[model samples]
Target: MAILTPGKPPRATSRSRSDARTRFSDRASAWLNHPMADIVLVLTASGLLLALGSIMVWSASTVFSYTQFSDAFYFMRRHLVFLGVALVAGWVTSRIPVDRLRGLGWLVFSVAGLLLALTFTPLGYGVGGNNNWLNLGGANSMLRVQPAEFAKLAIVVWGSAVLANKRRLLDQPKHLLVPFLPFSLLLIGLVVLQHDLGTAILLGGLVVAVLWCVGAPLRVLGTLAVLIAGALGTLVLANRSRVDRILGFLNPGSDLTGINHQPMQALYGLATGGWWGVGLGSSRQKWGSLAEAHTDYVLAIIGEELGLVGTLVVLLLFVILGYAGVRIALRSSTFFGRLVAAGVTSWIMMQALVNVMVVLGLLPVLGVPLPLVSYGGSALLANVMALGVLVACARDEPDAKAWLKRRATLRSKAPKRRFSAVLPGRS
Candidate 1:
C-alpha cells in the first residue's frame, strides 16, 4: 500500500506567464523601437511594385515605343524620370507634418479645380478622344498633365477636411448631401465632358466611399447612389458610342467586325495565353492583334505571355498592396492621415480593378490604365505620387516608433555639429 507518488512539476501561474510575456514584449519593443516598421514595409513594398512595374513596362512597351518614336526605350526613360521626381517629392512630404497637409488640402482642391476649368480653354490638349490634359509649354512642349489626377488627390484631402469639420452632422443627410453632392458632381461633369467616363465613374465611387467611411447614414448614401446610377445610365444612353461599348461588353463575340472588336480580341489574347503563357515577349497578341496592348489592355498582354499564373501574380500583388494600404490607414493616428491614405489606396486600386475587369470582359471597356504597370506618362507619375502619400502616412504611424527614434537621434547629432562652430571651435 505504500508506494509514494513522484513529486509533480509545478504548474505555471498567470503571474509567471504574464511576467514572461512582459519580458518578451519588452525585448520585442526594444527591437522595434529602432525604426518605423510601417514606413519601412510600405517603402519596401512600393519599391518592389515600382521595380516590377518598370521591368514590365519595358517589356510591355518595347515594341510600341520603338515603332511610335523610333526610340526603343522612350516610354521607359520617361517613366524613370517621373519615378525619380515622385520619390523626391514623397520623401519631402513625409518630413512635413500631417497638420500642415490639412491646410494645403483646400488650397490644392481650389487650384486643381481651376486647372480643371482651364482644360476646357485653348491651353488644353485632346488625347485619344479625351480633352483632359494641359499643355505646359517648354522643352516638354507636348508635355501633357491631367488635372483630373491632381483633382483625385485633392478630393482626398478636401473630403477628409470636410468630413472632419462636419463630424457631428454627418448623420444628417441634408448637411452631408448638400455640400458633397454639388462639389462632387461638378468634378464628375467636367470629367464626363472630357469624354472620360472611366475617370468620372471612378471619382463618383471614391466620393461615395469617403463619405460613407466618415459616417454618412446608409439611407442617405443609398439614395444618392441610386440617383447617381440613374444619371450615369441616362448619360450613357444618350451617347451612341457609350451604348456600343455596353453592347460590346455584353456580347463581344457577336460584333467582332464592329463595336466588339477590342474586347473580342482581348478575350482571344487571354485564351491564347492558356495556363503557363507563351513566355515573356512572345505574345502574338501584342503583334498588332490587340489595340493598346501596352496600356489599357496590358493585362491581356500579360495573360498572353505570362499565362494564368502570371495574371494571378498580378492580382496577388494588387491584393497585397491593398492589404498594406488598409493597414496603414487603420494605423494612422490622425483622421486626415487615415482618410488620405485610404482614399489614395482606393483610387489606385479601383482604377486597376476597372482596367482588369474591362480587359477580362467582366465590365464595360472604359479606358483606364493598369496603375504602375500600365504604359502612360501621366498615369505613371500621378500614381507614384499617390503612393508617396501612402508612404508618408505609414512612416508617421505609431508602430514606426523605432524608426522615428533613429531619425531623432540623427537630428540631434547633426544639430550639435552646427552649434560647435559658433562656440569658438578649433575651426
Candidate 2:
C-alpha cells in the first residue's frame, strides 16, 4: 500500500483563501466595534429641534387654522403627520451606506431637474407672488410639489460628487467651469423663474462652499462669484416685483401700507413681545397680522412668544449644528462623506441664518424657514432626513459614539428592577 501524496495545490489555495477571509473579517469587525457619539449628538439635537418646531408651529398656526380651515388644529395635525414621515425618512436614510449616496448624484439631480423644468407647465402654480409649486396631475386633486427643495438636495449630492472626483483638476476652467456652471445655471434659472430669489442664493452659496471645501482654485471661485453676481443683477432687473422688494428693502418705510406690510408686522410682533415674550401660544401676530407666520415668518412668532432669549437659543442651536457638522466633515473617512456632510451642514445653517436675518430685518424676506424650527411638511421632512445623514457620518468616529454608549450602558445598568415585580405581587 502506497501512501498517497496530499494535494498541495488545493490545500495551499484553501489556506490562502481562509487567511484572506480572516483579514477581511477582522477589518469589518473592527469598524462595527468603533464608537459613534458624533452621530448621537447630531441626532439628539435635530430631534429636539423637530419637537420644538412642532410646538411652535402649533402655537403659530392655530389661529390661521381656525379662520382658514375651520379646524383649530389643522396645521398642527398636518405638521405632526409630516414629522412622522420625516422620522421614517431619517431612519431609512441613516441605515443606507454612505457610499451609495455618492453614486446617486446624477439620478437625484436629473429627477429634480425635470421637476424644475415642469414649473413652466400649466401644472405649476404661483402662490404669494412666487411661481415655485408644481401641481402635478391637476390643480384640484394632486400633489403640489416644490422642485426647489429637491433641487437643493440634488445640488448638494451631485455637486459634492463632482468636486470630490475633480479634487485636483478643479482649478482648470475646462474641468470646473464648463461642466459645473451650466447645470448650476440651469437649476438657478428654474429657481429665478419661480421668483424664489433667496433659495437661489442659498443654492449658489452651497455650490461655492462645497467647491472651495474640495480645494478648487480661488480664481475659479472668484470667476463663479462674478458670474453669480451678474446673473443675480440681471434677474433682479427683469422682475418688477423683485425690484420692488429690493427697493423696499433699502427703504422699508417707503411703502408701509403695501410691500412692507409683512416686515412691518414682523417688527411690530417682535417689539410688542419685549424681554420675556408675551408667553407661548398667546402671540398676536399669528392672528393674521404677520403673513405666513408658521411657514416663512415663524421666527417672528417665536420672537413674539419666546422673545429675544428664544431667538438666541434658536441661533445657538444653529451655531452648534454648524460646528458639529463641520467637525464631522473634517473627521469623515471619505471625501464624499465630508463634502455631503459639509454641504448639508452649510445648507441648513445658511437657511436658518437667512430666515432669522429676514425675521430680524437684516435681510429682505426670502421666505426661507428656520429648518426644523419652522412649519412646512416638505421643509421638516427634508431637513430631518438631512440630519439623519449627518448622524450617520458622525457615527463613524469612535470616541463620540463610545462615550455615548458607555453613558447609556451605565444608565441602563444603574437603574433598579421594576418595583412591583421586585415586591413580588403588584403585577
Candidate 3:
C-alpha cells in the first residue's frame, strides 16, 4: 500500500477513460439496434435539419432579399411557405402504403417525364445558364418549377419497381437494359438538353443504385460506370463555363475575380467562422460578399455563423439520416422497399457530398444545393418527400411493423376516459 499525498487528488487512469468510452459505445449500439430506432432516427434527424435550414436560410438571405425585394423577410417567408408544402408532402407520402407506391411507379414516371418535356416549350426559361425551369405564370410570378428535381424522385420509384419485378432477370444484360436504360436515358437526355448536368449526374447515379440493389453483374455495373464517367467528361469539356470552373478549381489563385470569386468568398466565410463561429445571423460574407448565399453557398453561411461546430452538426445529422436510410434498406421485407431505400439514400448522400465538397473547394462549383438545407422550393420538396418514403420503408420492416402493431393493439385495448373523469364534475 502507498501513502497518498495530502490534499492531492488521484489522477484518472487512461484505462478508466477507455472503459467509459466502450460502455457508452455499447449503450448507443444497443439502443440503435432496437426495432423502432430507424424510424425514430430518421424523423429526429430530418426534423433537426429542417429547423436548422429554416434558420440559416433566413440568416443568409436577408441581405439579398432586402436588396432585391425591399423586404428583408421576403426569402424567409417564401422559404417557410415551401417548407409548409414539403411537410404536407412528406406526411402524405409517409402514410402511403409502400406496396402501393410500387404500383404508382409508372404513373409518377410519366408525370415527371411530361413535366420535363414542358421545359422545352415556350413556358421554359433559363436561370444561371441552365434552361431547367418552367414558369407557370408570368416571369414575375413565384410559380417557377424545376422538373429535373421531380425527375430524381421518379427515377428512384420507377427504377426500384422495375428492377424488383425483374430481379431474377437482372443477370441478363438484355433484361437489365431494355426499358430501364431507354427510359432513364431519355430522362437524362432531357435534363442535359436543359443544361442541368448536376441533376443529370444524380439521375444516372439513381440508375446505378437500383441496379446494384438488385444484384446486377459486376461487369455490367463496371461498364455502366465507365460510360457514365466518359459522358460526364464529354459534357464538362463541351461547356466553356464548366471548363473554366475546372481550371479555377485546379488553380484557385489564377482567377480571383471571375470563376473563383464565389468559391474564394465562401472559403473566407468558413475561415472567419473559426471554431465557435461568429454567431448566428452575424455573417459578414452574407452581406453581399458571397453569391447565392441562400442556395448554393448556404453551407458557407452556416459555417460563418455557427462555426466549425455548426457545420459539423449539420454533417452529423446527414450521417444519421444516411445511417437510418441504409438500415431501413437492409431491414426492408420487399425488394421494392430495398431498392427505394438504397436509391434515395445514395441520391441524397451523394448530392450532399457534392455540395459540401464544392463549399470546401475540393471540387469545381456544380451549382448543386445542399439537400433539405438549400433555399430552393423544388429541392426541399423532393428531399423531404423522399425522406417520407424512406420512413414508410422503415415502417414496412417486419420488426418495425410488429412493434407498431403491438403499440396499436395496446392503445386500442386500453380503457378510454372522458375529460369529465379528470375534472371534479363527474365520473
Candidate 4:
C-alpha cells in the first residue's frame, strides 16, 4: 500500500484509499488509548441501555398500563419524554466546567436537603408503604417527584468536594468526621423517616464509596461500618415486613404465595423465558402474573421478554460503563474530579447490580431501579446527570488533552491545495 506513494503524493485512486485507512487507524488508536474512549463507551452503553429499556418498558407495561390508565403506551411515552429531558440536562452539565460544578456542589446539596425535608410534609405521598415521594404538580396533575434520587447525586458531588479539600487532613479521623458525616446523616435520616430503607442504604453506600475513593483510613471505615451495621440491625428489628422479606430471601422455599410472591413470580417469568425470550412483548408473565413490571422489576421483564441473551447484553453494557467510568476517574487530573467521578460511578453501577440481584432473588427486594434502564423519571434523569459529570471529567483528562494537541498539530502540519486541478486546455 505504501510502495508507490514513497516520497511524492500519488493519484487519488489507491493512494487515497491508503490515506483513508491511515486516518481511520489514527482515530481508532486515539479512542482506544486515550480518555476519549470513556466518552465513547458512556454514550454507546447509555444509548443501548435506554433503547432496550424503552422497548422492555413498553412490553412489560402494556397490560398494566392499559389496566390502570386505559392506555398501552402510557409508561413508554412518559419514559421517552424523560429520556429527552435527561439528554438535555446531561448536555448542559457536560458543557459546564468541572471546577464550577464542584463549586456548585454545596448548593445542590442544600437544595436536595430542602427537598428531602419536604417529603415528610403534607405535599409528600406514599406508595408501596414508602413515603419518599413528593407531589410536584398536585394530585390532579399526576406528577410525582422522588427527592431521594436527587439526594444521592447531592451527596456524591458535595461529599467529593469536601473530601478532596480535606485530603491532607484525612489521616486525622476528626477531619473526616466533621461536615461529611453530619451532612450525609441529615439526608439519610430524612430518607429513613420517609420509610424508604432502600434509598437510605443506597445513600449510606454512597457515603462510604466517597470516603473510600478519597483514601479514608481503615479505622474510619470500620467505625462507620459498625455504626451502619447497628443502624441496619435496628431497622430490621423495627420493621416486621422487612424482616419477613429478609427471611424469605434466606429461605426461598417458604411463603411462595405470600411474602415471597413477587420474587417467585419473577422466577417464574424468567423460567418461562428460555434462551431467546418469548419474543419481545409475548411474555406470559406480563399478562397478569408479574407486579411492578414497569418500574422496579423492569429487568425481570427484560429477562422474561428479551431472554437470557438480552439480559447478558444488558449486563455487558453495564460492565463497559463501569470500565469506562473507572478509566475516567484514573485519568482525571484533579482530586475533586477523580473522587466525584468514582463516587458517581460506584453509586450508579452498584445500584444496578443490586437491582439485578433483587430480580434473581439473591438479595432482598430493594425497590431500587436499574440505572438508566428503569421506568422512573427522577431516577432516570438523576443518573443521566451523574453520567454527564463523568463525561465532563473525561474531557479534562490529561491524555485527552494530549490527544487534542496531537490532532491539532497534525492539522496544522498537513499541506493544503486548491480544488482546481490542471485543466486539459486552460492549464
If scored against the real structure, what TM-score would every candidate get? 0.84, 0.83, 0.94, 0.88
Instruction: Point out where model 4 deviates above 4 Å.
Output: 1-30, 140-142, 402-427
Q: Which sections of candidate 3 miss by over 4 Å? A: 1-19, 419-427
Best by TM-score: 3
TM-score of 2: 0.83
Q: lDDT per residue, candidate 2, 1-427, as tens digits?
A: 5455787433356778899999999996675444553564576677777777888999998888999878889888878887888899988877666778777788878998998888888878887878888876553332567788878788888887776777677667688665666887789878987888888998898788877777777888898899889988998899888889889999989898888899989998888778879999999988878878998888888888988888777777777778779889988878888888998998998888888788888887777888998887667777887887777667655465567678889999896876543556654
Per-residue CA lDDT of model 3 for 240-305, tens digit only, reads 988988888999998798889999999999999999999998999988889799999999999999
* Rank list by lDDT: 3, 4, 2, 1
RMSD of 2: 16.8
- Runs in model 1 deviating more than 4 A are 1-35, 138-142, 401-403, 410-427
Q: Candidates 3 and 4: which is better by lDDT?
A: 3
- Clash pairs, model 2 backbone: 36-401, 37-400, 37-401
The window of 10 residues in a row where model 3 has the poorest summed lDDT is 418-427
Model 4 lDDT, residue 26, Cα: 94
**How far does residue 260 in candidate 2 sit from its true spot (Å)?**
1.3
Residues 72-178, candidate 1, lDDT per residue (tens digit)? 78877887877777677767766766777777777877887898898999888787788998988864553778888777877887777766666677667777766
- Ranking of candidates on TM-score, top first: 3, 4, 1, 2
Better of 1 and 2 by lDDT: 2
Tens digits of per-residue lDDT for model 4 on 333-418? 99988988898899988899899999998899888999898888999989999999988888878887687778989999999876
Clashing pairs counted in every model: 6, 3, 0, 0
